[model samples]
Target: MSLGASDHRAIQPDNDDIESRIEAETLARMHKQLEDRRSFLQRTTSRRSSVCIYRVPPSLTEVSANTIAPEIVSIGPYHRDRDTVLKFENYKWSFLDYVLSFTRRNGNDLDKIIRSMSDLERSADATLISSADFVEMMILDSCFILGYMYLYTSQEDEPTFSIPIVTRDLLKLENQTPFFILEMMYDLMKTINGDSLELLALKFFNLKLPRRDEEILKSTYTPPYSDQSIQCVTLLQRSGIKIRRVKANSFREINFKKATLQIPSIAINDYTTTLFINCIALERCTPHIRTHFSAYIAFMSCLINSTRDVTLLGQDGIITSFSQDDQDILFLVGIQTVIVILKHIA
Candidate 1:
């Protein structure tokens, strides 16, 4: 008898239906998880506008994939849209650089390793990857690297905030992962935030993740000011975002399904509480559509850690931070070595 698609048991010899069942269940779970993550992230837009960024470095390789295939197959095809290219490139680099060093490398179980990766392809809204099954194993190659980028750019680095390094390559990498790798990708992501960045930076630079008045963000918790009069007021004069006032009813806007992720304990107030959300059913990702996430990080850092030198704003090192909403805990780091100091003492 042919096994149903959802059967968990692996197809033993002579079972023709086993492969199809496994593939179908794999795809079903992949899409379900993607939708859940995208939905949850959208709802949290009031804070964490750019979300986290990742990068699959160029040092990943085929031999490593074969070695790790057992652990990877433990969970059939998961989200790995970006890491495919990263490993492809990295393998070439590693091979060229380490030819002499690798000749003595062991090749035990080499055939099974290569066979496991022989045929593969990935397709998803944000990426489409086609390669041998062995190639798909690149997904696990960059967990530590991704974690590094998160630690490098997270909120701990005040006034001088920056985007994670992986966020930089995301534009280029998302086009390749077959839909199967998305879940594994999300799993690796959980390791980036929290204390990773702060701890690493301190260890490397003999420095600290300076604590700005945490209360600044803690205090934006009053009621919102009733001033939607200025429909769009931009704090960054240089940023070319179109801004206008939201009149009581004259609105021309894109449709993004309304969703909210509320932290119930916090009630924050601010004169400028802005949102630019699209309510359309987003189906696919245009490769490289988002050019830069760091700009947003820089801008937010300035807001959280620096006071306005003039009405327009200040980029100098003199820093004072205040969060507009407790939810948007924009931390900042700064340096003012170039600015001349003026003395006024009695």
Candidate 2:
């Protein structure tokens, strides 16, 4: 209040110095935050378009890991480190040897396969391993699949591995290489194999659902949604809604016509439970894909509640159970346990 001109001049410089220091600190923090944000955005967008393989979400695994986990073989990076699957390493190498023998390209087939997969490493989400290891994994896994499919389709003596269990393991969401990888490998060895990869796979899995061309034309991939209250199988049957088998190409081709709930016949086996669970997991992880599989499972869960429902479905050939025990059949289709996880995704 009583300061001289010299005192004012000294205070002004101090104030200016403090303001400059504050401004520099604020700008530095802003730059750091922006840089961090930019790096995060780039990392996320880089993998979004190409990421196809995924581990089962912990929420799902918490419900039942047995259904989601691979038992015998681990095909891709997600479960590659499993000790249970590691025992099959030699078998994969054996299959790779078998594959090379058919190539007739003087050891060039492997080189070509590895090179092709190396090019795909970027798009195939190769962060789980080194670039060399990723390509190697792709090559070995692809050969094993093709070799197995070849032996399976050709009926060239039964495979050393249990056909059903290995088949089931191969379908696990975590235990898969990209289909295109297998296709490219097969193209190189197709001269020795008689069928296309699609045909071979369908035959190997025995997924031949009888389909009418006209019914396939009528098939829709939309999830079935209803505003009406859902009813159990017994209640629906009591209400005179007949459940009949509709031969269609896709499981999502469910329809109602003339008081008949026409659903495609589905085999409820040891594999059925795991198969649908993995499919649901895939749908949940990949949001762009429709949740038809999850919706269908949820719809089926709604319909199947009691042994009587399972019996009725079996009588109609809508559900053919490979297991003899009623409880096992119930466990496979009741799969209401999956409904808990589906609620989140569906």
Candidate 3:
């Protein structure tokens, strides 16, 4: 079951990390980067997602009066406090934000959105993400991955999964839900107008409701709904799947199919700056071609990780809102990758 470093990596046939000496300074830099990963940019960036965190004070009704739950919930780091939300003028508050003044007047619109679909009596037909929400389509890839197993199975092609939801029972919205699910879901649903098969896979691979107030922070850039597939692979290894490493040549086609390709770093274009200039076109000619696409992903990841576009924020007496173009590039790559993945599926 061990999908050791060997099985996961393509360029290397064996333990790649174990191959060379650990260059100390580079490793140290990585650790430092992890530590400094949090940014003031986050503070300035406005985000509203379904995920958030909370901590419940042990009921103050006398510390030992008798505990009903008897355990501190690992649910939140809670996002839904009235005081936490700031109400803007004319009811234009952050939609994903559930905090602030809790009067019926301020939150009535949200209540309406949640209730409108509950009318779908059975969870079977309920639209989880609102029909009208605008969100990124790449997330559908993850949902497709989640539902893939069921689709391949003999389930009569009917959706048969249930994701946890808190309801307008915002009062009962607790602090903990299994995390990764909500994180990706929030990211995936950021634009729901998405009609990709990747998005529809959301029907399976559903989750137990997350505790209220816990926001899903996507630490890694995975195609949407990929969590279940990755998790399943991991668990399989744990259960003795014995994943083995093979060269990029082994998966030549699929690699290219999902890749933003680069020719090997040979001397091609003699420009003052290096762009992935020697771009050769790739077209999917056969089913076997998909295997090779992974190599392209590896190259793309390197290009993505190594290059960064650091921008000076707006013309604030000082600069502001600067974002790494790499991030935007990654999103673009994801959207494109999903289009290719779905071509075969569709």
Candidate 4:
């Protein structure tokens, strides 16, 4: 009954063949998994690098999520479906209708608008949740923005929402369609005469802040620390450093020379806070953009530690606070967490 040597040899060859096949199959699966991971990484890197619009980071939201959220109207996909924002949806449609009526164009104009927005789909923030109808949302939001700007500049009838509140809402980081979309809608509608969309926007906001042709940002630049902690404005004064307002158009033109810190006088109000916070968020999300706002904010936060600092800055005309409560100014500029975040980002 015992097997002969030749039979045993034959069985050994069969076992060797099975083991080789099993190893080959396992190696094939391993190679496939490696390829899949590389593909996933490539896609993610491409999306992250090119994305401009982004949802506010959770680190920032932890301070105050509502700071970046739209109050009156949601202009982008991030908050379009919220119950509070849904009420304003009807107004957007009304604005679209007004455009159609004014232009003497019918559904064909609407179709053209949809097609144009659709072409820019790739530019939408990759981090955003996919909208059911992104083109429709873009058209409606752009129309609302253009219509509001027109109403604001003309001073016709008062809009349903207060002008300042709506302006703040429109500028929210999460509540923005691309500026190009606004321009496209404006051109298609032919609603305004003899004014570019950029001019209309500048007029609508009435911003004194001037635009720079080029912003030189040294991303590798690190702040020189004299001590473990940055001194507040009062402390800086005690150290024989004079702080005063300079006649500069841009707030970013801050300079320190011969112990004198010269900063452009900036208005601090609810609207100003909204603008600053949105600009900071934009810079944070899009790394390629200049971090002027974030750096400015971190520097301001370090300078204004208490009400005394705010008072000193105000007396010097470095800060013009529209808010009656000095504590509000303190809260606006004393965000220590933001300093940490900005430092890490830098």
User: Residue-wise lDDT of candidate 3 within 136-213, one digit each (tens)?
Assistant: 111222232222323332254433531112111111223233234333433333332333333322222222211122
Q: Kindly report which residue stretches of model 1 are placed more than 4 angstroms away from their true locations once superposed.
A: 1-167, 171-311, 315-346
Ranking by lDDT: 2, 4, 1, 3
- Candidate 1, residues 1-346: lDDT per residue as tens digits? 8778656344444455667788889999999999999899887752232312222221211112221222111212333433543343444333222321221243323343234324222222123234543343433332223333334444455324332222222222322233323323323234424444334333322222122333212212222222122111133333443322222110121111222111111111120111100000010122233312222222333334323322122222111132433222321222111000100110
As a TM-score, model 3 comes out at 0.16
Order of models, best TM-score first: 2, 4, 1, 3
lDDT of 4 by residue, 1-346 (tens): 9999998887776777889999999999999999999999999887555434567766666566667888879987778778878888888898888776654553446666666777777656534555447777877888888887887666655456545677888778878777777777777766546778877787666533444424211133424332256689999999999998998646777889989999889888777777877777777777786667677777787898888898899999988955556776765553557657666777
* Candidate of highest lDDT: 2
lDDT score for residue 182 of model 2: 82
Off by over 4 Å in 4: 1-52, 101-108, 115-133, 154-162, 190-196, 208-230, 322-325, 332-336
Instruction: Candidate 2: list runs displaced more than 4 Å.
Output: 1-51, 106-109, 115-125, 156-162, 190-199, 207-223, 245-253, 322-325, 329-346
Q: Residue 119 of candidate 3: its Cα lDDT? A: 33
Candidate 4 lands at a TM-score of 0.70
Displacement of the residue 76 alpha carbon in candidate 2, Å: 1.1
All models: lDDT? Answer: 0.28, 0.75, 0.28, 0.73
